[model samples]
Target chain A: MTIEYASIEQFYELIEPGLNSVELAVYAASITTFFALILVLYKRLHHDKLNTLPVNISGFGYAIPGTVLAMAMLATFGPLDNLINEWALSLNIEEPGLILSGTVFAIIFAFVVRFSAIANGTISGGVEQVAHSLDLAPLSLGMGSIKGIFKVHLPLLKSSIFVAWLLVFVEAMKELPAVLILRPFNYDTLSTQIYQLISDEQLEQGALGAISIVVFGLLPIIWLNKNEEKS
Target chain B: MTHLIDIQQLAVKLQNKTILSDVSLSLEAGDILGLVGPSGCGKTTLLNTIAGFIEQSAGKIVIDEKMQIDLTNLVAPEERNVGMIFQDYALFPHLTIRENIGFGLFNLDKATCNSRVTELMSLLKLTELAERYPHQLSGGQQQRVAIARALAPQPKIILLDEPFSNIDARLRNELMIEIRQLLKSLNMTAIFVTHNKDEVFTFADKVAVMSEGRILQFGSPVLVSQQPNSWQVADFLQLGSWIPVKCNGDSAETAIGSLTDVHTENCQTGKTESSIMSLLVKPQHIRIENNENVNVEINHVGITEQGYHYIVSSLNRTDLSFDRLSFYSHDVFQLGQQLAFEIIHHEYLMFDQAPPR
Candidate 1:
């Protein structure tokens, strides 16, 4: 079969999965980054051995193979789903089966666990650049701790937060193993679509999807380079 | 009148290490207290303790004789109604000058907040830069914004941690004078930390000299200078050179001359009769005695606004020898030149030599 010039047909076929990929990446990155910032703030304000526990555990996720992490996620949430279903049955209520085990929530949860270390490391490095006194200056001015963080810290961390979101978003877009194993039935993302076409020896048909993942992956790298140059 | 701030037996521990212990100080309304010490002397820790940033392991802090803070009744920093200006100024880089100054005024109505911010901006001569962010302003301008922000809420007492340290040395004195005058005009009670005793002399109504997590002395600058209570305080202040002397009855014999009618402070009663004592010999207390034998050799010479300044070492008296004897005169002296000098008759100030570290 001759490879034809790239056609819009392949691009048209990728629109649905591309949207799905964007949605998953956005949801996972937002939640992951939010929790990362909170963890950083907690560590800064409270000096305890336990402060590093959650970060360490989350960071450990990045070291695990994606397939293993997907299995772990299923193993963890699958039982919780069964427990909830049993409780519902006990109460004679309708069982909400597999609410977390094989849904978008599970995919997002896996992404968060897999990429939290990236967000935490980036945001933590940013927070370290800020003077510790900035944390107390607002408190001295009669602003509560929460408000002080919003007024002083969050603004200062804006670039770090953006970079972290971009990094996780890129990772989520290209992630294949975890998505392949955990994505709900009939729900296809760019990664899954690209993987399927390649498995079927129709790599040309998935060229647009593969290119889309690569382009998404380059965004944060380019943005980071520009920022490094600016700084 | 009740004191604006009364701290009693304040102590702080961080990571199982005691940072401050038995630190007590009181400041009246409108009085500016300067906390001066070498680095790691707990001046900043004391300030942080007062500002409620660091929890005290022991002791109590009373603000305006109304709010009392102790280990049992710890108050959060924001609710303490105290303000602090950090050494780095800690100005919010993202906020404009006006917005930074108005930050703590969130409790006030919009009209009140705007008025307060405007008034502070004018007072600090920052009206022209109100729209500029902290990073866009000069160090002095950023410091002024920090001051304005700390003062906006009208807290009972303000804590300033080396506020002028970031300023250019050439501008530091001028800025200190202006800020002191402004604080005086507002009748604001404040405590500022610095290692420069000169800053205290120029800006503080009261001075506290700290060493090794303890306040060695606290009094008016003149009083502390004239009657330093300990060897550490006198030595840290550079009040004078230490001349090893032996006390016999009412007089003390030194390498230079005998100081009669010695009045010793912090000198052990029985030990002073035989053991060596360090006399605080101010530069002005020494006079040239050309007719007498040369007793000191000039080691260092430098010019000052006062005149030729020389640091002389004892010539031959090893038992009573001393170095760094500061002397000022109109006559120039070469290094290594022997000179005749005698301690002028004055109220004697003596302290026991500090224990060796």
Candidate 2:
């Protein structure tokens, strides 16, 4: 058998479809925003009950296997997708079918379900590192609870939030099993494209895509090491 | 009108354990109250409850006799117009000194806020360090920034938790005096907690001694030292060593010698069989006698600014075992040196001893 890929340009050309996909960008942004909002809401609404069930359950996703999470997402959203499509057909909306499960929504939903724990854990740990007295300081200084969080806690957690976002972004970029199961037809993120190339025994063509995933995955490790040095 | 902070029967229970119980105290508008107690004695809990960090389970906390907080309806810390200086300073490490001080002044106009920050910085001697972060400042400077931040909003009351504990012991007194002057100049009503009783004398106008979630006594520092209401207060403050005595009506007989004019204010008035009582023997009240018989042996000795001080224990164990009396003089005494001393003429502060083992 002949190896078709000969140069870096060829590898780039083969993986360009995955790199330039708007759906992948949208999925990454969607998961990041969704996780951040959930983490902040958890902190604001139930700060006193941080160790309670609600917060712990929200962070439990980190321990879940990606394949199991993908299947769980499918089991929940697939039926809901059908119910929505049937309603749309009855309402005479032109061509509605499998809206959530058939598009990038499925992949984004799966990503959020699987990776939210990373963001929540990082942000929670950051919040914990701040002296509880600092939170009370703003309140004693004439700031309300919400205002105190915004003025004091958020500013202090800025670095943690950035690190959380970067970690989730990189993880999403390189995650394979979940995206492979949840991604709709013709939707190819870097991980999904590289996986398909390997499955087809054409890994040489997707070398640049695989290298990119490895490079992206190294960011969080480097960041954690730097933080370890700091502390 | 007599009180600015009127806490009536305030109680706080956490996780089924009572942290503060019926902690009733009041402070005048310009008075500073110092809370002193051993570790885990609920002093910090009381301060936190007043600062609105911990919710009270019962009773009421009234501010200026108008705003009252109780079990059912609680005022948030911000709306209560209270301020706090945490022990660690908690100076918003990410913000510069100016920003931290000006944080609470956000409600003011920009120019007004700037002027207020400038005034406070100069008053606190933090002007030169305005642009520096908290980590860069020395401990004392960070403390000043924390004070400025707490004072920025001009709250009716402020709470401080062991603010001087982090300072060098040598500089602690100087800083305490400076901060006391600043608070007095501002006419700020405040409550501070410290385990060190001496701090109450140097920093506070009033002292409240607490033990096991209860206030044992609340009075002027001098008053508390002179007359601690309970054994816990006397022991915690270390007002004087206890010399066991046999009570006989108004007077008591001690190891040093039989003494008249013993005050039994805390005991029953009527006569009864001789019972054990503890006589408060301060160092100043003991006089060294130049006599043939040395009645006591030096147990310990230490040098002080006034002179060398010695703790002398009774030589005869049956008279009173392990009972120590302190004596201070310019004359240096040798360790284990036998000394004869007599109790000088003074009114005694005596309390009944717990039943013997």
Clashes of each: 0, 0
Candidate 2 interface RMS: 0.9
Instruction: For model 2, state the Cα shift of residue B6 in Å.
Output: 1.0
On residues B37-74, what C-alpha lDDT tens digit does candidate 1 reach at each position? 88999999899888888889999999999999998899
Alpha-carbon shift of residue B65 in model 2 (angstroms):
2.2
Please provide, for model 2 over A155-188, each residue's C-alpha lDDT reduced to its tens digit, 9 standing for 90 to 100. Answer: 8887777777777777777777887787777767
DockQ of each: 0.91, 0.82
Q: TM-score for each prediction?
A: 0.96, 0.92
Per-candidate local distance difference test: 0.88, 0.81
Q: Over the stretch B274-302, how does candidate 2's per-residue lDDT look in tens digits?
A: 77767777878888889967778997989
Evaluated with TM-score, which candidate comes out highest?
A: 1
For residue B157, give model 1's deviation from the true position in Å: 0.7
